[model samples]
Target: MQKGAEAVHAANPDVLVILSGLNFDKDLSFLRQRPINLTFSGKLVFEIHRYSFTDGKSWETGNPNQVCGQVVNDIMSRGGFLLDQGYPLFVSEFGADQRGTNVNDNRYFNCFLGLAAELDFDWALWTLVGSYYLREGVVGLNEVYGVMDWNWCDIRNSSFLKRISTVQSPFQGPGYNESRSHKLIFHPMTGLCVRRISFFQPLELGPCSESDAWDYTPTKTLTLTGTYFCLQADKSGQPAKLGIMCTNSNSKWQAISDSKMHLSSKLQDGTNLCLDVDSKNVVFTNTCKCLSKDKTCDPASQWFKIIDSTRKQNTTKSFFQSKQIAQFLGNTFSYIL
Candidate 1:
């Protein structure tokens, strides 16, 4: 790999060289023992790939929370650790079925988006072409993972596109300094965040760009930044509101379930309620759903990912430059792992 990288540099020194892990670009832990002897510096980037099928039917058979945690831990140990070592890690390939009907793919994607938001790594969608003319003696073979339809005219899933828009911009990294770390209550199902319109208004799900900055305190209270109000639970079907009473049982939220995606809190009536959203995007606290091992139930409305962000509004640098670390080197980062 080092020799190949040197040759590539010898041919074109201006381009960045990316290396992939073994075992089909999924394992890079071997780097801990046998570091690459690359002579080139600043142009070295590592890549990794992940997909729903990579772990078989784990999402279908195991608990979603446990499955998500296990997959994230495995990913970190495999290649995500490079980010901590000051190396640029590229998620070269990662996608799920765009149709959104497959149970396994649907559940896996929810977890995938949450991790992607947290990592904020550079990534490439799995595919673009929806259909091919010929492959293995087939005509017009369809690519279910393609972002576009089979005709390549319209997007296959518009909501899917919106869901990924949050991570398309880097939340925090080098070349950024104005951002103060805060939490954004991201709903993976809708690619939106919990936002408060006003002190007197109820909370609602809106664009992440307009999400209210929040601070999850050590006391389990989710308080709005620069405000004394905490997210308080009301009746079972009532919209969640901002309240000054921070110590009350209704304001203290606990991340329940194995995935820890369910932000559950007690109501004034002692009812255990989870943060949920209605069809109109109104945020509320409802009796928790699918807290057990029920595969048929869809708990998407209740799955909230508290993503950490340090992106301050009104940064002057160009938006493109802040998207990926590789952009700093004046090269478009794209590589297959």
Candidate 2:
């Protein structure tokens, strides 16, 4: 592999040389013992592939939080650690069944998205093609993982596309000059973030780019950055509101599930409720469900991940105004944006 990388750089020094790890491009932990040596400095990249099947039905049987934590740790130990070592790491292939019925794939995606948002690494979806002309003696095989429909006329899953769109832009890193740190309550199932319209209005889920910056304080209160109001709840099924009385137990949130995705708070009556969204996109608090061992229940609606970001709030509007500017920013940030 080293010789091949050297030859590629020798032939074309201008192009980046991406190295793949052994064991189907999923293990690069070996590099920790022996670093790569090349004449070039800035153009070397490492790549890895991951999927729901990579760990063989673990997502189906195990708690998502535990499964995700274990998998992410393994990935970091493998090739993801290279990022900490100052080298670019690319998720060359990662995708899920877009049909939305595969339980394993569905569970894996929530876990995968959290890591993606945290690391903000460069990645390539497994494919764009909806169908194959032939594969292994089969004719016209349909690719369930493809982003497009088999006819190639429309998106196979628009919601899935929307969910991934949040990570399409960089939250930090090169060309992202923002220095302020804040949290965005991201809903992987909806591809939106928690947002507020006014002081007394109920909170709603909206475009992540318009998400309100939040602070997860030491007291476990979710406060709007630079504001006195904090997220509060009263009943188990009422809308989660912003209020100045933040010291109450109803306003103190905790990550309660194994996946640590469910943000729960104790109601005044001692009932534990989780952050949730309704069909109309209203954010609310409801009875915490499926904390563990229950695979039949779908907890996607209650899953909220509070991810850190350093994105400049003031400049994001301009970045969305022009496609040219968005593309320029993406390129200028190098491989990770």
Winner by lDDT: 2
Best by TM-score: 2
Task: Give the distance in Å from residue 264's predicted Cα in candidate 1 to where it truly belongs.
Answer: 2.4
Colliding pairs, model 1 = 65-259
**Residue 87 in model 2: shift from native, Å?**
2.9
lDDT of 1 by residue, 247-266 (tens): 98999988887667899998
Q: Which stretches of candidate 1 lie over 4 Å from their true place?
A: 175-178, 267-271, 313-337
- How accurate locally is residue 7 in candidate 1, as Cα lDDT from 0 to 100? 94
TM-scores for the candidates: 0.85, 0.86
lDDT per model, in order? Answer: 0.83, 0.84
Model 2 lDDT per residue over 140-251, tens place: 8999999989999999999888888889888777787575878888888787889876544689999877888999999999998876668988787889987666898989
Judged by whole-model lDDT over C-alpha atoms, candidate 1 comes out at 0.83
